[model samples]
Target: MIRHLGLCLLLLAAFWVTPTAKAATVCTATSTPMIFPQAGPTQVDSNAVVTVTCNTFGLSLLATARVRMCLNLDGGSVAPAQIVPRRMQNSFGDPLNFQLYSNPAHTVIWGGSAAPGVPAAVQIDLEYGVPVLGGAGTATTTIYGRVPAQSGLAAGTFTNSFAAANAVLTYRYSEALLATPPWPTSCLAGGNGGASTGFPFTASAPVASRCTISTATDLDFGNVPGAIATNRDQTSAVTFTCTGRTAWNVGLDNGIHAAGTTRRMRLGTSANYVRYELYRDAGHSQRWGTTAGTDTASGTGSGGAQTVTVQGRVPAGQMVPAGTYADTVTVTITY
Candidate 1:
């Protein structure tokens, strides 16, 4: 009886030491479908949302896993290509040995193919570890890109798919949100916001004043008969009337010439035939007068009318010419 009891105890010990078969669970994940916009300018704005869930299946804390995202051009009908793969991040913003790849300029087309000239689609793969403690895990990530016309993509439709997997974990897939980009415009008066004023606002050309020689008289020229003379003097009165009531400055041009002739003669010369000897009294003696023997004269005039008399003289001639000799004088006015 003692031997039999020992045998039963040995059998119980063996049964207690035996290990039981454990169930296997694979890590899995699901992603929402992604869509793209059709006809648009080179630069189009768009956004997409993806939801990923992971299950550790009550694994040990030391157990690690990986997640990947891929883009399938030409619709889900074709195989997905890997793009940027990022490691999952912890509660902190630090990366968990992960990376992400994306092309902001991405567009889709029909015919179960990516836009004819469109670049290869982008893909992202993420890898992470399941916490030792059993709990539900979830992450929602946003993906954005722009569509350009150069990619041979016209106004059309597109689709995207996502998948996740682990060695011993299960995953569920969810639909992603695809939205059309917003368009912005300018709302000013003109296309250039009233920047360019079409018409020019400029004044007309100034009207030149019309001047005429009114009166001229010889001063202090005592009668002469022979060649060579001295101390001769004369005076002349010149009157000017402005059609428009505008102030003007009357000055000598020093370009005195014979009538209808281009040749210029110097002031106080025989060819000039007129010399400004000295300025006598005038209404405004202080302002209207010649500078010593200088031929030029300067003075202001009233708007309606004004007159100035210039005092001058000629040298005695040894023999006075018989014929009438004429000299030209020029008067210029500026307002």
Candidate 2:
């Protein structure tokens, strides 16, 4: 009976010396950079793929390890009091505002690289003998990113680098039999059974110089009464919007009815013509023409709506029957 008791003691000692599955658990993480296409006045979105892998070693069949993990992203190169709305910077030290999200809808801000904001969470299950992941479980998640609509000052590359703890993976884990009913509910739920890791990443995008020409009113010279007698002048405005610092030139094409570079107004599809001209200045000194380098109006963009005055004139001295006359000229911009 003494020998039997001693054997039981030995078995108990062996049981106490055996290491738990959680002891061998070591987690790691990696990610792809979030990159965006050309940015504009409207919001632009992007995605990054993050993967977390937790390993469980030296466990028998049917043994399982469960993990509660929190994934957090801090403010990038541009540090803000809050991590929800982060900012990136250009080489010139200019700022571009952007944000990271946990959900596809982008309603849930991705933060908690430090605290306060909710950290992204995941539940991982590692079956020791499962060949699928070779005794390890992995969780893959997508990080949604956005750059809100903004008026840009210049066209250049904006970037943010996430490293040295900016991107973090904090986790808590426990080992149990396959039939165990419960596990940690969150990364912080398992008390002291937690650790953290880091993975570096970056966010970058370029804003190309963009320009749009808005339509304008036609040059209406009103009604020309009787025969051509004096010069008739009218003005119209053409508006264009572009990114700051962009150089553009505005040009005017000869109307549909033109006689060898001379703009003319037509009389109801007949052979009759009325001589009319377009100019770039109010004084009508600079004749506006389609030649971009010579006769086009040039200016630098201010990232706001800008106007170009289209001055029209009828150098009245032509003999024609009194009838309705019209002409349509195309407006073009060269950058």
Candidate 3:
């Protein structure tokens, strides 16, 4: 019985001597969200960094460490995956396609790098021994981001939140009993000193200037008296629309039968012509021509459709032309 008790004691002593494995320690981390300026037709790329730091108390105990950072992007909702073509949501629920890359080259994927339980996190692996020294172990990793051509989206600020479900930075680590490798020169004697929260960012773009002009309108004065009789007048209008505050000009070119401001319309299929003139005001003055601001109508756009009228008159008695008279004038708009 004494021998049996001695064997039991030996077993208990062995149990007490054996070292127990402990759970991996998590480090403190802080990150700044990536910001993208106004996007254009070409790809707009940017970068931001997240610093992961470990307290000195447990830094020396960790032999070799492995870390993975993940990005959960919802674009204001839940994302299907973490690959290219990731969308961002606007206040109006509109979506814009964008991408998050693991490296500067954007070759590897950072998909699902969060804690073991979270499935939607996109992750990237950093260099081992990120926190080399025990006192203040800290390391920084770059997040490469890009917003492809999204000219179709309206001009405004677009964003993704990281606090709740959209875009958050998550991390996990594993350690062993062996010694960690030497720290890189960049991270040597450095550590993340501040607190970190979820990473969020903004993507934006400026809408290009746009303008449009309508088709021409015909100005006709039918059946005018021949030998310097009474004056015949007609009116036609052209409509145009443009962005607000845009400066624009409407210039009317010399008609096919014009001779240096002396306007005339030719008889159909005949060399004979009838003299006429186009004016801007009612008094048959202010001749409309190709010169901007002087002969052409100028105005500031109010972001709506506007109409400008063409005044035409056949002055009393232009001799010639016994048949149908016509003229073709080209309208030009410069904005």
Which model scores highest in TM-score?
A: 2
Better of 1 and 3 by lDDT: 3
Best by lDDT: 2
Q: lDDT for model 3, on a 0 to 1 scale?
A: 0.60
Alpha-carbon RMSD to native, per candidate: 28.3, 6.4, 10.4
Per-residue CA lDDT of model 1 for 1-335, tens digit only, reads: 45544444444444444232121223233333333333222334445544545443444433333333233222121122322221221122222111112334332221111445543433333334444453344555444533333321211123222222110111211111121112112111111111111111111111223334454444334444455366454566667654232345555433345333232323344543323233444432332322323333444333234676665444344344433334445555544
Model 2, C-alpha of 183: deviation from truth (Å) = 5.1
- Comparing candidate 1 with candidate 3, which one achieves the higher TM-score? 3
Candidate 1 ranges with C-alpha deviation above 4 Å: 1-39, 58-73, 76-101, 105-133, 136-143, 150-335
The sequence of per-residue lDDT tens digits that candidate 2 reaches over residues 177-262 is 34342456667666226688987899987877777898777888888678778999999999998777678888888979998899
Give the runs in model 2 whose Cα sits over 4 Å from its true position.
1-24, 37-45, 56-65, 79-84, 87-98, 113-135, 146-158, 174-194, 205-208, 225-227
**Residue 72 of candidate 3: its Cα lDDT?**
49
TM-score of each: 0.24, 0.74, 0.53
